[model samples]
Target: MSETGRLAVRKTYKLFVGGAFPRSESGRSYVVSSSKGDFLANAARASRKDARDAVVAARKAFPGWSGATPYNRGQILYRVAEMMEGRRAQFVAEVVDADGVSARKAGELVDAAVDRLVWYAGWSDKIGAIQGAANPVAGPYFNLSTAEPTGVVAVVAPPFGPLLGLVSVVAPVIVTGNTCVVVASERAPLPSITLAEVLATSDLPGGVVNILTGHTGELAPWLAGHMDVNGIDLTGCDPDLARTCEQEAAENLKRVLRPAKTDWLADPGLDRMTTFLETKTVWHPVGI
Candidate 1:
């Protein structure tokens, strides 16, 4: 294999929608260059139809995926880590090429990304409890609160660390049973596309984690204000642009995660998890 890793992707990369790869309905393809300015491939410029199709796919796949047992989701996430391990070399190579980093640093970044997924996978079964609590009520009613996935999440990944940043944001959303519509890094679409390949081969259900690669300024607003999108992770956005997205997201009362300046390459604890999760309360009569 050419050290950059071998994926079953196309020579001319296309948009992956509804579990099948299709060329842009607009029949327009944009040149995607590597971070090093090397010609990567011509990526399809997704149309409004494509975005709508992605939402449809995500909606169709939501219930089953979100309803799956947390343990099962954890197992699947662990499986992704395993699969990624087998392909670590490829990711490392790609990261090295794309970021113009040395092989050692590349390996570290890839390891961070994989480790992130593994961390979030473990949280799959634990987050519901950690972020949850029993509410004290004045009445004789049970008010136990637990966290649930915030439904379809729209993630505009940070521009710098495409691989790790995207994984850091997207994995947490789905690990807790929320589906996602991601606008991957514009400058580094290949790695995101490569992630799609990984998710496809791994146990992640389609639509649960849809990936889109296009202009951030163009796609971020639509994703933010999309009626179907319930939450958003604005981690990858520019400062002023993030404010705009946050404002638009409020139009639908979409849950918004403000941009964090913390080091995402480091381990992200439950802080990130609790931010987007919703507290669900279940009540039962203890009286017999």
Candidate 2:
């Protein structure tokens, strides 16, 4: 290894957005210690401004990334799956420490999360065809229905199923070509930040996935009511907060996905993908 390559460097972890790593706009950070009382790293306590910045980054990258062909997006999502495979051990250990699950269960959960990424990756190239179809109309115009991303999505992943839930929720939004501003599980933000690292190293474009670590109750309402946010996935929100988010979402008619009681560890079908998609219809002239 070259001298620069082999030289030891201090480790620094901070908020990731707009293709760069910058400290939180609030300039506030929180400590993350392991169960063994060993400090892991400092997690950024994102603020309203930080959230707004993430939204801006997401919005800026949306048009180009979303306009890309599904095949290209599929390739990027698949790259994330490959990256996850190489870090399986790290994720399993994080899950065990954060959620207090057994090693085997942790491994299983990480596997589920990685597999979910691959599953959603495959959907990127196929959902448009599956969810889109021709609309038969009596008029002299030809009509077709297609699906498109709802733009900047704000995601609240569940607390318990940190790894699986975050992957499950975020993958669907971006795989369909939507940029996202996500609040990681407050109790277990490590895995989410680590996942951001994976995305950074993978083929995903910047701002395609912006992750923040902080109090969900404080951040959720801000993201929910933010005018720039096009949709919200409340899979991680508590019942009371979820209702409030639903109410606030009506102002912009933002697409709101309420938390589900179903088991994500069991098997996740097409339901997650459908929630982040919009049906677009196109009409053309066809004469006999």
Candidate 3:
């Protein structure tokens, strides 16, 4: 067929769960628009039920993913960067439409997102070395402690810098073998689903990172209070919402990273990765 005769494929933005794109079980979608209020596309408005389903998928995926070697996980993350490179144009366009930034600025954001993935990938295999230590116990035993993943995490991605911020939050969580359910920027969620496409095809296992598009206020409470979730990052919530989520999270003693003034462009320290990690110590007889 001639090029002109072919059709341009249309994408229906849907919730990314279990490595597959599924519309919200509630069968509802909201109109996504540009910063100037121009219509862009319709996106699935995920419900609390969807949040639970994502958590289930994340919990199911945790064992295998956490069991994999850090080097293997790093390689998979590098693969995600490669995939993002291939879809640069789409991501840049989405960022432009979502944030009303110039093409060049969007391009820079896309580049940073790719680089951020690579940066976290490099840390994957080295985290243990930097964070683990040998205890100086006064006994004939070798006492060693190392960082381990904190199981399934719930994240509220920053409302700004949809692509870079989303990548910043999600990459670190998964790089250390923790699976996550993220609520993307409610104002500019288009780039998130596009990112999910990159993850789905980049050899990443299903359910390692599930993204939901909708109101953070509607979803944060349920994710925070869920008994099965091990941590919640309130990076996107306002003070009031963060307080509510924190209270809910306290019910299960979920490890919570409180909302902070974050400069997305600044050097992201080790906190994001370390925040979702727990230390495991082992003791062995010195001579045995």
Give the number of the best model, judged by TM-score.
3
Judged by lDDT relative to the true structure, which candidate is superior, 2 or 3? 3
lDDT of 2 by residue, 96-214 (tens): 87877899999988989988888888898899899999888998898999998888999988887878988988988999989999988887788887788899999788898998888
Clashing pairs in 1: 157-236, 158-236
Give the TM-score of each candidate.
Answer: 0.92, 0.92, 0.96
| Segments in model 1 whose C-alpha atoms lie over 4 Å from true places | 1-10, 136-139
Ranking by TM-score: 3, 2, 1
Q: What TM-score does prediction 2 earn? A: 0.92
Q: Which residue pairs show collisions in model 3? A: none
Error of 1 at 101 (Å): 0.8
Instruction: Select the stronger candidate by TM-score from 1 and 3.
Output: 3
Q: How many backbone clashes does candidate 1 have?
A: 2
